[model samples]
Target: MSFLDKMFASIGIGAAKVDTILANDRLVAGDEVNGRIVIQGGKIDQDVDDIYLKVMTSYEQEIDDKKVHKECVVGKFRLTERFTIKAKEKREVPFSFELPIDTPISYGKTRVWVETGLDIKNAIDPSDRDYIEVHPSPLMSKVFNAVTDLGFRLREVECEAAPFHARRRLPFVQEFEFVPTKGEFRGRLDELEIIFLETNRNYLELLIQVDRKARSIGGLLSEMLNLDETNLRLTITNDNAHNIKDMLYQVIKKYS
Candidate 1:
């Protein structure tokens, strides 16, 4: 290789480029993701040490009393071992992986993407990012429908820092917030916050926080101190999806 060509490749000029194309961008959590990595050789041959795919998303956390956004990887997959791409050559590698059950859904400010990168020794790595739409799983859909049917409107959805004890495999948890607009709990409760603690093909575990409205002076004082919120865990299986509305109603009613 010419000295100039080597210098250019080192800075990513005329270097191999990578692009990942998914079979379908719209997917549900716990589903399989199929895709292929396409690499186009540039002006010179290069040795690719490895190829990787990472499922990434971002969450907000309070740092020094200020909200900061940071990225996190949900999963990672290796596609290929050491390989060489000749000048002006093109290559495609197939890949498939199970989308994590706890992958954050594409809702509100949350976004999920797949990052493809090629590792080249002594050369700048070429990378590509493709965003995907992640929908709720079957059991999660049931719970969301139940809440909407009860006249609770979705207020906001966000991924936030999770306390150490409450965290699972991730450092943060996705939270779904709702407010009663015209239901029996409208005046009794201020809001309802739901967190999917654990999910699988068979069942889902949720952490529900019920915030009650202040009634008496003592109640107002407790609310002012952020002590009027009740936290509870609920587990629902496929068989219980049909009655999820009633199941959730009773729990909220008890606290409201």
Candidate 2:
């Protein structure tokens, strides 16, 4: 049987049902997550003292040199309602709350899951989990686009398991990886990794790793570049692009 069915059976309530209806399935940071909770009573009448909603996200962890998995609670809300439902009765309760901006994006889309449940003492709780997608603002898109235009292909995007201690408000961090394009460092590097930290300031931290290609006589040489600044924009003009080619030729001339 389904999880809901099993929960209701444990409560001796025959078959309780719960459903959630969201006003808007798509939302963004600083937007309200409005929805209604629907609960259907089972074979007999029951009193629900309260209702609660829990937002959760599943993320990866590292332990013993191996990857571990865990789910974290992002937020919780309690409804101030005590109602009685008769047998074969259905009830709908409305709820509206603001979503935290730091909510992790899942499935390449900015969507998070929320689970709603009823608090009936000594009874199996009826719960429902809903997924809502959030869209980032134009500023966020600008930063992302700039990186992509720089020939930095996305490697992987994930939320860091640790909470951003610097900023107590944010609970997770998003990391993006990119592979450098063939340029002056064509055969001299492997990839670059970027991590976006949470802070009141609207600046992004960039970490670049230069992996050197193996040579016949020498050992591998790797370098890292860390950039922390604001209003950062990287552009490749025709003149500069050509100049880069000249610079590459000069470098080869000196090395070879």
lDDT of 2 at 33: 83
TM-score of predicted structure 2: 0.70
lDDT of each: 0.94, 0.58
Residue-wise lDDT of candidate 2 within 1-256, one digit each (tens)?
Answer: 3566546656665856788889997766557888898888787666788888777776665668887666667778886678877768988889998776556555342247888887766677788889877565434455456555545456677655554453344444555555656444445435444444431123323233333444433333212222211112133333344343343234332432
Stretches > 4 Å off in candidate 1: none
Maximum-lDDT candidate: 1
Question: Under the 3 Å rule for N, CA and C atoms, how many clashes does model 1 have?
Answer: 0
What is the TM-score of candidate 1? 0.98
Q: Write the per-residue lDDT of candidate 1 for residues 77-185, one digit (tens) a residue.
A: 9988899999899999999999988899999999999999999999999999999999998889999999998889999999999989889999999999999999798
Model 1 lDDT, residue 101, Cα: 84
All candidates: TM-score: 0.98, 0.70
Give the range where candidate 2 is weakest over 10 consecutive residues by summed lDDT. 224-233
User: Could you tell me which residue pairs clash in candidate 2?
Assistant: none
